[model samples]
Target: MAQRLVFPDAYAAADLITFAGRAARAGDGAVHLRASGGTLVTAAAPLLRQGLLDSTPTIIGMRLLPVDPELDCDLVVEAALLQIAHDDAEAVELPETAVPPPLWSAAEVPRSGWSHAGTLDLAVLAERAQWGMSAVAHALPIDPGDLIVQAVRGKIWSAPDEDLGGLPRGVAFVARTLGFIGEDAEDVGVRTCGRWTRLTLRRGHVLLRGPAHLGMTEVRETGHVAALVD
Candidate 1:
């Protein structure tokens, strides 16, 4: 069975990218990252270590996707052996198999202008809004009762002061500005959008200096783990 592992938020996706990429480097398996077609990252290997993706991990960002209660998982290795071996029967030999790499892809933005991880990735959202605020604004609802605003405030204040330092700058900035509602609701909404840029320093969400593939060297140097397998 092809398993559908959904990352509830952008931070969650970044976490898997770091962990799986590191796992491959440490002889856990192979990992690849592709920026094309949704910034895909995949790790194809049996996790030598156990309990890596367990429990509801603390997410610092709003989740674009639905949450899964039973986060406990043991991605079985041997169960996939036969299918992997069968790949050899094809005319072209099966190059890689059996090892199921932990995978992550940037989920598309939802109807509510919500995102799984990259949803609020500030640059893209802001640029789009700048290009045509009217179009983007139609999709995102900004009111005191909005879910995004509440989620952002809840995540930031709930965490300890020391832990808050590690959050993405954009997110932290938004959290800091909380309760300072602007005279206009639209202005307040824009403020929330401004603070939601991608945070790549501690995690694997990095801005590429040059081409996406070449940029991965920076990620590798940072000891950030991630991969994209075609």
Candidate 2:
């Protein structure tokens, strides 16, 4: 993996920074960057399981941006570090050192063969996300332990959205939190390939692999999640 990635312009770099920043705030602070040809794919997990028995489905928010095609790289690094690198006005390339990839990144995701399943109403997604945020907030105690908080979140976010063809509510949460759904945003597109279901919007995509591919053991799970990219 290359240590540096150069965007075509400052505007392009800023776009990635915005995504990384939002992702950092929404989930764990790490972001995965993979380069292929002239495009850079950036992905972040907004909801993930933390243990072997945890039921949370892996939810990834991803976006693409143009980058210099001279180098190809795939790595995970802290979002804050990327922002700090971008802070330097004279730096054209973002410099990063790899961090341990998150477990969700190991899951296998389909690259092609997506068939349009349906469209998700942006208004419905927004409302569901808002309700989820409030539910999580009101459910946690003042000094709730990490496990308890994670459990509560996992349950709420993983609840299937019956109105939206049984897609997990966490998908909506990821889309709204990552700024994928906006006031003027049209209905988000939905597609499926194998066990993977993807919610596509103009800004980016949110992907969810069905529970069957989640893997029963931690090691197996992480390996599968990280296989999202070639």
Candidate 3:
């Protein structure tokens, strides 16, 4: 039986990248950030970190490749271990073992602008996730339905008065719920995108941001409630 993990949002990809980049950096490994066919490998934490943070929120396919053929089977295992340790990830998938080598590599790489694939996991990613979440949660709170937004350009915005500071409690809760955290309050922003509300913040604002997509409903649902009230 093959397990399929579908991440139908860009935020999901960004989350993976951030998790992977941090793991790679911490282990003194390298990360190659390529969208189509351009392999831009770098070891700079700031650059890779920013790439993960600034990624547009959309759905893209991600395939994890192994650095070596012998390590192929351990790809998913490594990802799970990273998630368990980091607490910044939820799920991952493994490729079919019987697939042809060339095709497997091809599918793992993104084409045009549809999906992306790569390999990582040379170090202990779990600890990085744990520490990152701790740092983020320490600064904010976590809540269901909170929209994680980024502060495109600004400083720490004072938490709103009236107990609406928008921060959450646990770092793991925030990591599991909001894909990424901002560096500070001013770097976080909560906004609604289409049907899904997004919490856009820097890598550090994980806790300080709050939900921005409450009470939202489709036109049909809204009309039904209106009729009932009338």
> Which candidate number has the best lDDT?
2
Q: State the lDDT of candidate 1 residue by residue for 1-230, as single tens digits.
A: 34333444545454443344343343234333222222333322221112343211112221121223443332323221212112222111112333443332132212133112211233432333233324324444666354553344333322322222223222323221211112322111111112232333222232211111111111112332212110
lDDT assessment of candidate 2: 0.74
| Model 2 agreement with the true structure over 36-145: per-residue lDDT tens digits | 78788889998877788787767999888888887588888888677524455422345446789888767666776766566667788888989988999999999999
lDDT per prediction? 0.27, 0.74, 0.27
Candidate 2, TM-score vs. the true structure? 0.84
Residues forming the 10-long window of minimal summed lDDT in candidate 2: 215-224
Predicted structure 1: lDDT = 0.27
Q: Which stretches of candidate 1 lie over 4 Å from their true place?
A: 1-95, 101-198, 202-230
Candidate 2 versus truth, CA RMSD in Å, comes to 7.6
Q: How many backbone clashes does candidate 2 have?
A: 9
Candidate 1 TM-score, true structure as reference: 0.21
RMSD of each: 19.3, 7.6, 18.5
Q: TM-scores of all models? A: 0.21, 0.84, 0.23
Q: How close is candidate 3 to the true structure, as a TM-score?
A: 0.23
